[model samples]
Target: MVDSPDAFGRLWADDYPGDFLRDLAELGDRMSGRPGERRAAELVADAFRDAGAREVAVEPFEMNAWKRGSTEFGVTNPVERSFEALALPYSPSGDVHGDIVDVGHGTPEEIEAADVAGNVVVASTETPPGMDRLYHRMEKFGHAVAAGASAFVFANHKQGQLPPTGALRFDREAAVPAVGVSAETGTWLREYADRDGEVSLSVSADTVPGEGHNATGVFGPETDEEVVVLAHHDGHDIAEAALDNGCGVATVVAIARILGDIDLDTRVRVVTVGGEEVGLLGASALADTIESERMRSVVNVDGAGRYRTLRAFTHGTPAFEGVLDSVSDAASREVSVDDALHPFSDHWPFLKREVPAVQLHSVTPERGRGWGHTHADTWDKTDARNVREHGMLAALLVRELTRKSVPRPDADALAADLESRGLRPGMEAAEIWPAHWE
Candidate 1:
């Protein structure tokens, strides 16, 4: 059994995680390929150095970067009213006028049933009830593209005036222009659509070649096998990104401090990646440098520090679940484990390469991104207690993983699991399905 340390007492004394989160927020718009993102990488590298990590480095990679610009969405026929909208990343500059089609929840079934061809399709950010998993925004966008929709509108389901923003595709221009609207505006749009109203959408944006950075360092004993602990430092430019990922990188930093004092059998590599908001660019870049056999396991702290209780996606790896169970039992802190395959997040790039990986998220009552991609994702929405608690659990999990000899997942079996979960269809639609799986 792994012994649990007084993580709360140690963290509470200094509140390093809280301070790190605040520092990241102050960087201002750590968007991928931006100056803020570069500064954030430097800050994380400095934190890693201070945490006693060795060979700390900031790696750079080229990426297809996108910039937000003026977006206009309004009812044109039978009414004249404009709604506040934000152009999703990778949305090309265009002007489209078509009849609005509401595809509730934006499920495959809904898009297939609706006559969305040559029309603007609006889908809610929330998934349909009773669905096994939440449909991602990219999946909805892909479905609309496949159906030949002239444009796509993502409507936030939460009852706030905040419009959500996310990438339309990974590292490429979307087939159609896309934008997000507030829940209130969504209601108005739905009502107007019932009246067979036509709407107009104009988006102005730029897609250019840009660079992404990954701040990386190593701790523990030098070994051929390493356990990766990673979180994305890049966030949407819309908010302070406190909840979406600022908490994640901070938790990673806090865990690094704990790992520095522990004697481990394997090396622990801590990485704070950029371009996760646009795509998993930084993660993919880092993954390419490391061979799958050398990676013992990956513990990604993406949405981990958002709540008190932690939720771990083990990616159908039995060894990962076992480790989490042991950590929970030893630490006496419940970590809700789901042995499911989650294809999003920084872990995906590694998991797709047949590396055993676990993504540490949180247990939240809300279904969709509660305040994740909106302007409301600020530092005020997070609690330092959650960061400290989650960091402790993550550190414990990492420690256990380093000592264990977990087998790598079979590539065929992993692909089959994704297919069984009905994720392949969406992945294929999103153009993220690995060619090897075919």
Candidate 2:
């Protein structure tokens, strides 16, 4: 708790933020498609209207909903053993009560060796090697799924409590419904198979193209202007996105409340993209069409509730460095300026289109860490005050950028910076020079 001049909370408390916290707490409840989120979005729209914005609408997008499918697993042998497990978030359904075949780790080699056709494949957890192996393993898994394995069940790893879980990312032509299971369950299944010779179970689920949406609404009017602020609204569909992004939307809405009441020289756009959990689809869509010419910069807020280590970075040009500093100058003392990878959020698409953007974030390790696409990220982990601070920082930053014109770097300098950052051409860093790096 450093007594710094740039504490964002003081600003968050400004403008008499009455009932804003209550509104944020309610946001969690309203977002569940359950009364929580449904109502939360409504409240946001209402607030937008009250803010005197010209327009406010909830534009819906399509996304598939993964529901529970028929699930049954047990060991059929001298000793009857029933193992516990559940289908992955987007797993396929297989009611095959056939014998369970040990496919080793469900690896391609293991699958090829075993006769798993029409049979359930009890797979062991196979992490190729290093932390970087996840990518190759995932890609490999996609190929394995496409190879026509009847069903995929990930055996528990030596470590990791819950079934080693993951979602499949196949090319446009390939799709596989895979689920992970607990390591204990895997061991039991294996032991049962060794003792019983054959173990049969039922694993069926409602698997198909899911349909949901990336709901979005823009604030402020047209002036060939853009100050895109982002927060992902979608979660695993189990918990309220309170801190995961419920707070993010709340922060964005808070900014709307602050900046909306006053007239600004530049437009302040707020987008709570969907399918962020699944992928950066919503953000990508915006990035695809955003008039880079109009886009000044993007400010993304994620995991705002706990700046236990709030950090910011600039992956953009020199002007963006100024943008980052401008934002940081008003951020909390708890916030640090650290180097990070890509925004990896809805901002990627904008970057692809050459829009200046960066994701404001904080990272926390958990008992079962890396809950990004897991069921572990719940509402209980959210902190309201932290979320408020996140919103406050964004509002102040946007206000600064909208009016203050920073020094734009020349093309060569911008190019050199992008190159040093290992940027690829046509991606976001390709073209720069004499440009605002917009």
Candidate 3:
């Protein structure tokens, strides 16, 4: 038992004594469905068993494995120059030459108005303030694909030589060559788009069908209803992928260790899924096997614990706000809540089913995946103190969610909420909008 809120605080302080840090450092570069990801899953399973969780199981699922290869992006017209570029994961090998069409900020409206057919489309990774939701890399690429573009280029918003990298496709191969460039390179590309200069894109990669595992463990009571705490173990191959998910995986492990022995009214399942970066494949796989009605709620920790404070995406489940408020108030912890239905994380599979859920992440003043999906996503950007403290808040929330009951939302209501949130345009452009909504 946690005993009291003060005791929980002390536990959080004492828990991050440095052992978990060493563990995370050892699990370096956990790319989805690869050896690094497998090692991470094994480590999490061992930790769960060591924490006294019963029936700890590592279930395997099939995933399309994507191997990174060399990429070449150059402008042949208006002063020939080659810019440094990184190939997005799951991008197919191709050689393409077309006119560069710059879609400023890559909004749905911009994509719809541009004549990208048989041309190369260039979009920024930054999301404009006028949009209600964040524009994802794949969404931007999807817009290009929808416009019949021969290739896609994503430029970083950050002012550095660092090129952004993310999965171009999930569970399937990309239809066109997709690459990322730095902000400086993006400016150069814009010069070409302004004059309608010809750009050449060449990509080389390999793909094979592979498998990834989900580390699942059952804690607390034996009940029909289950509250699942999930975090993805997979990350991009560019860097250590620490802040993007390493902090999340470690925090979930610590939460399971602390709350496993406590008595509760419902069962709590700790899940560390794989193939998240390549599209929430592992989470969707697990959700398919489980009965949706049996799922009480989900607390998905993806980009959380990177900062001292934590925030949550409630996905329009107002019933979930009570749990967040109670836990934050009880622990005196800083946990911000956003009642938006963000369809970008591991919680999306469950949320699409109308199961109540929240995707946990660290709040930042800057927008558009700051330091999230790049080579800069290393371990040093995070601290053990944030991990432990965030875990404490998650533990408290899990306990409360297990004790209390929240209402389940219907699919039609969720679809309507998406329209109200101004998310339907992006979803339709990205081709991920639910078919039933039509």
Candidate with maximal TM-score: 1
Task: Give, for candidate 2, the lowest lDDT window spanning 10 residues.
Answer: 425-434
**1-438: candidate 3 lDDT, tens digit per residue:** 544435455556665423664566567677776888888788888878877788898888998888887888899997798999999887899999999999988877887789889999889998877776776776778877987989999999898788998887667788888998999999989998888798999999988888888998988878999999999988878877787888898888778767755556799999999989888988999899889999999899987878767988888689888889998898777789888676888998998887888888888767777777787887777788888888878888888888998898788898999888777766776667878668
TM-score of each: 0.97, 0.67, 0.95
For model 2, state the Cα shift of residue 247 in Å: 2.8
Which portions of model 1 show Cα errors greater than 4 Å? 1-8
Per-residue CA lDDT of candidate 1, range 135-240, in tens?
A: 8999999988999999999999998799999998999998899999999999988888888989999999999999999999998888899999999999989899
Q: What is the C-alpha local distance difference test score of candidate 1?
A: 0.89
Q: Using TM-score as the measure, what is the rank order of every candidate, best first? A: 1, 3, 2
Worst 10 residues of 1 by lDDT: 1-10
Ranking by lDDT: 1, 3, 2
Better candidate by lDDT, 1 or 3: 1
Query: RMSD of candidate 1 to the true fold?
Result: 1.7
Give the alpha carbon lDDT tens digit for every residue of 119-162 in model 2. 55677655444322122224334435545655666665644455
